[model samples]
Target: SAPVAAAPGDNYVVDDALTGSRTRWFDEARFGMFIHFGPYAVYQGQYGSCRDAEWIKRQCNISWSDYEAKAASFNPASFDANAIVQLAKQAGQKYIVITSKHHDGFAMWPTRVNRWNLRDHAGFSRDLLRELKDAATANGIKLGFYYSIWDWHDPDFVGNFPAYVTKMKAQLQELVTNYDPALLWFDGEWTETNPTNPWSEQNGEDLERFVRTISPQVITNNRIGKRRLVDGDYGTPEQSLAGSPPSAQLQETCLTINNTWGYAAWDASFKSPTQLVRDLATLTSNGANLLLNIGPTPTGTVSAGQSGALTGMGTWMAVNGAAITGAGYTGLVGQPSWGKVTRKGNKLYLIVNSWASTLHLSRRSPFTVTGARVLGSASPVTVRAAGDGYDFLPSGGATNAIATVIEADIATPA
Candidate 1:
């Protein structure tokens, strides 16, 4: 008889010890910064017209020797860890996840497992990860590491897969032991067909288990084990938003600010600050966190366009952050065409994207609206009982042009 398959939530049974305070912190951290800095940044996501990104080495089909040579000259002189963390705080991001090792197989931190790392190969003086961890700690921000399981530079990856896994484990041990990261975000688990990527489901499980043994307190993502709901502590939907909440109790959507995850000098298409704020509200409404990405330039500085967008977002978060941070899904009111809804206790925040003179709630809504007011403003919104249900009328136009949040006080139905 075929082996019985595990139930929906049984594939990766988390140790009760792992999901204590750390998991709670993660759930409450509604927004975070994802840094994609690697050798690929040197290329600026361009190879003539190919438009390569973090996968520039594979996408452009560059020879290994050429890639290595280019990597040797990689030196980011202006990398400021404190400044980055400060920016995160300004943007109302409680946490950050930076790439420790991308698929290119270059470790940002000094690693003894291999010389193909920042300190040894690139001849860089500073420990990038250590600087970030220290800055994050000082700024009261949680720091996580994003490591790619696939290795393009490792010679043993194709010939002796287990040897590669052992090296990977050693590198991971270094990160967990030295950095003490709050989270470990794994990626590059997909089994591609071209060279026949050999990453297997069992590998993911074993790696996850190994991570727990070393640091039971750290949170990990589904990519650590087969990209399934049961693989790790939470589900990670990349490059796009999840249409609905995933089967995993905890989910995070990772999206790039521009078209590419790595620094693309020519890619000027960036989402407006209003759109990002709205995205945050939408994700929070579904009980999901948003991990927005930033691709730093070769000089180790955020581009003007990216930083400007982040500044704009920071401005909005300064005013209406309560609507996002620590907020969760509230089924009392269905999603309205005007905007999204998020709740914290008896407070239901209406993130109005399209301002209207009046907002209506159906009679069947599960909660009674007691009062309403603009989130960041001193003025109160008039709440009245209507024949159909409840009506909310703001005193004036939206206080914020991007997305105006109205705090609605509610009482549970009897």
Candidate 2:
């Protein structure tokens, strides 16, 4: 994705806020946790197989009213928002984007606008997001909200989107006003793509002026209207996202830590620590950030499997993230290997996709590397100067071989 420029001035916007500092901060801290939790986990074994998270209730044929009743069962007494954020921090995450309101229209917070939120139905009167926000801030993590604009139960919106743009604006106003969010991640305009897209029609550019007021300084994402909407601070690519670097303009991939974004008891298509590390590295190399996803159980705690994966990723970043953070790629065009690369000052962080005995250095940038080292370990790896670059000879007590960090000062292409 190319850089999306925001209208410069009083309010700077571009896919997401990528100020020199934000960019530097994001580049240094490459991984983040994308959380999605709701009433879906309760039906883990309802059918013959564990349902794909996004469609559990719908597949079970549960009525809207009946599903609402499950809100009381949504008690995640063990749901420790602080623990989750702490896990992300330990996993080397710089930020956490939790879903305050998904398509099901279940508000994680007790909204003044409606009582149909998790507080009323789930018998849990606590403001879930408030706690999350506090925990995230306390842990020094940037906070963001995953709010689906396409509300299935919001009669004003959904299929009646355009007709209710006024009401939709009101809801957005409430969302933006109530919570000072870092990013407003929206989804579900295409039924073929988003499970409940048909529930809400795609109303284009409806919140430009409204959002301008609520938090003009706030960041936004793609999927609003046209590609122009991509002008919101950052470009968000979903599960299709794997390897890509953090662009100067800001780019993020919202991928599930597990195969499914929602919680399903038997869904075990989770990516291994190797695949996860490689993907994170590749995204940095390609110029993007990885928003690893986690679907919390119906009661609110992230599953054990999800927890393990995130912690593993965090462990890797805690050591090797130096290259992934605080840098932009040199746009090494024609490089066959599609992986993420990050750069800061003179340091080039190459995130390898698959472990290789013989590492080939692509000649694109013209800058010569003065040195090389594995990310987490301070011990320098051996790399012989190639024709235009250097050849890295792999050696170490290899932590998951998927994403081995190669640090160097890349030669600037002439």
Candidate 3:
């Protein structure tokens, strides 16, 4: 698919008021983890023709009573906060955003406003969100919460809409006050099934203002209202990366490790480590962040396949992370056919996706090349002035099986 152009009122405008000092950290963080966990995992995408994970209730036409009953058996006994945090650290992720309350209206934390939560409804004793907060703080990882405005189990959502909003605000207060998350990722605001979602732009603005009053510095996504720039601090491009408004707009691409956001017993289409690394590099090169997702099983353990893929990415990050962390699109050079480019001050990291004997720049660059070398390795690369551009010749073959980065030291004409 082609990239979408930004239109008027598309919310691509950069609002300095909404994006405070925290936006810098978010941009440089580069990579983060997105966890989708709830009672829906119990179903494991088992609905006959629906075959959906998180949206199984609505898609499969499951009765509300039957869907609510899954909560009783939804004890994720093996959910280890420390292990999950450790996995994020191992994957070189700086932050984490877990589903606090999804569309099913099942809250992961024990909310004072309602008993439809992990603790009260599922008969679980431990506070899952609190445990994660502790683990994240101890590990030096920023934590965020994913909340859904749409409620399937709540009666007020369909009966008394304003009452539902009141309850929603109360729940948001509980999450921010208790957990102190660094960000809030909202969803389920789109009017897909319900022609009239009842969640108006005014409602979203009110909620955004209310959130700032509580946690003034916390970050938020565009889904808060109509997926517009004014609704939140940044845009969330889901599943596909082609929907980015423009390079100037702040956006994060949220993608799943496999086909589903929640555990699906038969969905085995997992992206390889090479592809994941390339995707991260490409997104970073485009001045966007990647929030890779993982759907943990009902047992609360990440499958070996998912863990292994993350480990592979971690292995690469351990060596060449400098090329990614804090790097941004420079626009100094056109995107090369063989690879992508990221920059930090005078250094240009040429990320070669498809290895070649001699990588040439698409056009003549203004910055003069001083020196070049393979990132994560001491091997020097030979640079020569070619026709209208420069060519980079590596001493040997690609260093890493995945994308091998060449750090080019450049200087402007003095």
Candidate 4:
């Protein structure tokens, strides 16, 4: 989504002090866990060649009545909220964001506004949101909710646009007041595809205003109105890292561990742990948070392959987390051929994804190094002045299996 510039004299301003604090906390928490589990898990994106299982109703072109019947059978008895939170903690994620309501309009929590939610319509008797929220709180992990504005099942949304907006507000009130999510990731604001009835950007802004009134501290994404960087607290870049590094707003890069955001029975192509860590490092160096997603199976359990990948990432974070946490783009230069760079205060962390006994910095670096050492270890790396840049010679044992983080004490040019 392209970022839109802020309008002149816009009154919809977030409290600067609160926004600054929240932004700092968000940036320091570089990695977050994204769960996309819903009734769609039952379909697993297996309807023909469609990959988004979460949108199976639309993908399969199922009638509303049939989809409602399908919701009646939805039961995730094996869902272990504590287990999921534990796995996220093990993966070194500072926050967890789960889908309370996807585009399918199936609310994970009990809602008074609609009976189509999990507690009222589906066979599940438990409130998934409450369970996950409680577990996240117990574990000291910040919790966020993903809410989609488009609801195919709601008749109000189908025929009455204004009524639909009111219902949406009521539901948002329920979520914010009951659960208190740290962030509210809104989607489907561009529900303009429906030729019969189109949702407008003004409606989105009004909805956002209501959300803020209820929960002023909650962070929101740009997808609510005009999918743009300045539209919300952060830029929600999904699937790929295509945009130039976000400067005016907080930035997040959301990606699935595999090809699909929702679980797919036929989709087994999972990204390697090494690649995941590299992406995390690269995003961190670019001053963006990585919201890595894991689509749980229909049985409410994360796939073994996905868990293994996260575990591998945990191993990497165990050693080189200093390079990520509380770090941001150094503004030294673009990402180097070898890897990336993140900075905190006077320290520069050179993340070496491709190991070399001797590494050379770009001529863009204007700092003199007093000392160099591998992060998380005291093993020193020899640094000497090159003509324009600097060269780092690693002491034999100063390396990590995935990415070696070298911390340099830099003296900036006067």
Candidate 5:
């Protein structure tokens, strides 16, 4: 069937097949880079137990006037767009999403509606988003933008809700026209409710309509309003993967490289590449994408620690990425005690993150194993048919290794 055209000002009805194509693209993309850079990076200050270091104003109870003052000196001279994109490419990421606007109400791009933008207020004068967009395109990576609905610094937000919404729409229009992002990630919709709060369900519907009208092909997340499962193009479960995959809906799990989403100079805790690789397998097996985040330094350099971790993950991804990309949840229920499983067609990927004497499977399956081999190496594994299941026998003693990808060809009962 042909797609019906939307009225001039009405929301476009996305074709079901187009939506599925978008979901399939997202599912196969598998990994992406999430960035949380803004004026907050200038003050990598910490608070006790507050993970969102980016929300420094709210967490520290700083006055809006004082917080806005930081923009005057917010100059990240070392921000290298090409370098960042290259690093993400090396990490085997397919896309990059950065904060275009945060709760601070400062637009990273030049905006006709707001004077408090990168060129005017931050005084950086360079269009950061444009640089990243070009770099991403050159590197064959998709570009996405993150925008916040809650504006603490916008004066009209205090009392005039309609005016604020108008301003938001205008600013978004600039983003759509100037940057042309593939994804629009909205945040800060769960702020305190007031008469002027523009995050009601109906308002969310309207905002999504505005977005679709501007960029018909852009995908949006569920944070437009209350972030209900039905609100947006995909589900965004932050910091953790969903226990069960959503029925026929897209899902992406966003996790920070460290404890905080924004740069925290004092925050030394970081996830090892091995743990992240294992996590990648675990999340992909459940039919989800992992959006790993990194908060760049105040001067806009990717921290050595973060870069090293990404490099390590790149090494692992170079070999084991076949188990992630183009893979989805297996028909089998529940996770294996030894490792996880990702499937594509009749191929089963046994992801082993830990060494075990034996590997187990679900008690019941309708498939018979034909062959098995370890990924990245010619090492062979022994697979034997057990009643209603199978057992994997490893050939070597590489238990201390980061992860092992075992590929198996299984014929499903038709």
Candidate 6:
């Protein structure tokens, strides 16, 4: 696929956070939710997370006709898409990214290009995608789509590369036209023949160019080569990252609430709310965003535990979201064991990860401490001008493990 070079547009630079466009907006979001659910949840007995190969093998071992049979019994009449979207918003997430299709080749929405979509093959007649889209729009959360490039059922793509690109283009065009997605996450790019492989730079660059051309505001994953996929965009890294996003730009790391991206029945590696909160704080302090994921059940119902965790985090966000959102790195002067740092105007956020009796630290940062207060609990904390630096014991309560907010006046670097 030769790159279809398009005329330049949207002069916004996403390469660095300060002079950025979409990256800045996404980074400002701080915490966004990733939804990965489908008919596969019903097969909890056979399938698991999308991350494991064994689960895939077990499920794929069955013939397509047999798998399609699951659709008949897949009655998620309990699906409350609005409630799920509501949960995301309540969780203080700024965006919602859903899996439109997985490797199983089952489409969540009706597709003109492929009839093997949820509306036709599955017994469910309703439109989950449209429902989710409406729900997200109503809640003020930006919507994005995750369409796996690897379609096991598509003969052109399954174990075949040369023919897959053409099919992909058509499917992508359909998605772009119908859903004005803000982000496009393309995964399942590795080859089964040789697992340790990715597409050539030419193919990758072409695909990335195609996406940029289609949606001027759309951002893409780093799975592709020589683009933002490998580069940091405002420091937000989605999926996985070898390191944090570059400081000049916003960076983010997208990880799952559980070990799996898609709904997995037996996947019990659910992350605690504390862990999630801590991870978000750590990333934000380092000038990054955290794209947390959740997989909805086939009938569009999110698990109770998942919902609870999200709401729990939301409760904390309600009181402390200001520190997490749109704040820059504290530059820490240097790293300290207390935790990480985030700053907004004159306020500096020190997210102490440890639970020590007292915190002892020193720093000569380009900022002046004016005041300090704990989030969730607005009580004054104590700070002292330590020798050649400063020290403080931040306030904490049963509500959260993270420490209090430290107000500081940032001075221009000399």
Task: Give one clash count per candidate, in the order shown.
Answer: 0, 43, 1, 1, 0, 18
True-structure lDDT of candidate 4: 0.81
The candidate that wins on TM-score is: 1
Q: lDDT of model 4 at residue 83?
A: 94
lDDT (C-alpha) at residue 191 in model 4: 44
Task: Please give the TM-score that candidate 6 achieves against the real structure.
Answer: 0.83
Q: What is the C-alpha lDDT profile of model 6 across 192-295, one tens digit per residue? A: 35442335556666776677667666776655444423431222355553354335444558887777666666667677777777777777777777778877
Which runs in model 5 stand beyond 4 Å of their true positions? Answer: 1-17, 46-52, 191-196, 227-230, 246-248
Using Cα atoms with residue i matched to residue i, what is each candidate's TM-score against the true structure? 0.94, 0.83, 0.93, 0.92, 0.91, 0.83
Q: Extract clashing residue pairs from model 1.
A: none
Candidate 2 lDDT tens digits, 169-201: 666677677767766776644453654444322
**Tens digit of per-residue lDDT, candidate 1, span 307-339:** 888899999999899899999787666778899
Q: Tell me, what's the RMSD of every candidate?
A: 3.2, 4.7, 4.3, 3.5, 3.9, 5.0
lDDT of each: 0.86, 0.66, 0.85, 0.81, 0.80, 0.65
Off by over 4 Å in 3: 1-18, 48-50, 243-246, 363-365
Model 5 TM-score, 2 decimals? 0.91
What does the lDDT come to for candidate 1?
A: 0.86
lDDT of 4 by residue, 1-414 (tens): 122344453333333345656566787999999999888887767756555678788888877877777678878888999999988888889899999889888888999987888889885888888999999999989999998888877777778989988888888899999999999898887746766446676776676677767876888887767643126678788987655553656789999898888888877898999899999988888888999999998878899888889999988888878888888888775567898888887888999988788888875757678888887777678998775688888876536778889988887887
Output the better candidate (2/3) by lDDT: 3
Query: How would the candidate models be sorted by TM-score, starting from the highest?
Result: 1, 3, 4, 5, 6, 2
Residues forming the 10-long window of minimal summed lDDT in candidate 1? 1-10
**Superior candidate under TM-score, 1 versus 5:** 1
Q: Which stretches of candidate 2 lie over 4 Å from their true place?
A: 1-29, 45-50, 158-164, 191-202, 226-231, 242-249, 332-341, 352-358, 376-384, 393-402, 410-414
lDDT of 2 at 91: 80
lDDT of 5 at 32: 94
Alpha-carbon shift of residue 293 in model 5 (angstroms): 1.0
Q: TM-score of model 3 relative to the true fold?
A: 0.93
